[model samples]
Target: MKFLLVFTLVSFIISFLSDRNKTFAGTKKGLKMFLGLLPTILNVLILVSVFLYLVPKETLIKILGHNSGWLGITIAAILGSISLIPMFITYPLAAILLKSGVSYRVLSVFITTLLMVGIITLPLETKYFGIRASILRNILSFIGALIIGLVIGIFL
Candidate 1:
């Protein structure tokens, strides 16, 4: 993480030196985008925190543990599809789930579907890509996520 921060800083400095106006404009735009997404990010984080607090670890293990099998995978996929978490939060949350005894297969499917399919963003996607295309993409992604999870289960 430190290396990434240093690398990004160096890249930004170089870009600024090469084209000050454009670099500043780009930075401003990026900041604006981040701010725009901040509220949604915070809401997801708060909900996740509350959920983790309210739900016991034993319950989570029962649902997502190694023995959970197909049931766990289905639950994870459904949750991932409906969630609107940021990528940054998803990874850390995955780590927490793993530590709480979630199976790798389940985590794989959860992460894949969370990243690939976005039911919460369906309206926006439909507006941009048309309802048919958006739904088709989501369906394909869901299938792909299942395949990926199965492969991971077999290998890991």
Candidate 2:
């Protein structure tokens, strides 16, 4: 929030000192983009809330908690792939899970997949990037994430 505030203030100052007309036009464009994304944002929020509500904490812990081992990592990857979580929320949730006894290995896999693999966004990706490229990218990301998690687990 502080960064955003600082950025906005700087932008405003730059605009005020330079071309007010262009600034207004840019701001209008930005607002329109935000408004267009509002529905998707709301849908994500609802999906996240319902997901958390439907999946019991105990079950989550049991499957992804310590002693779950490699199977836990696999499960975490799968869950992360399917869920469309925003990155801003993903890190804190991972931290909370870690505090709640989830192993680092599992969290590593979860975070990797959360950032890299996007099964839910595949259609949009394919639409823009073509189906072949999208599939290849996703497949590579999934494999790369697993490798990264395994490497991190080994090191830490």
Could you say which candidate leads in lDDT?
1
TM-score of each: 0.70, 0.62
lDDT of 2 by residue, 1-156 (tens): 699899999988899679988888888998998788777767766775686678777776777776687779888899988888766567656766676667788989888988899999999999999999999999999999999987887787
Any runs in candidate 2 off by more than 4 Å, and if so which? 1-62
Against the true structure, whose TM-score is highest? Answer: 1
Steric clash pairs (candidate 2): none
Tens-place lDDT digits, model 1, residues 68-103: 888999988998888977785687678867887788
How many pairs of residues collide in each model?
Answer: 0, 0
Candidate 1: the clashing residue pairs are: none
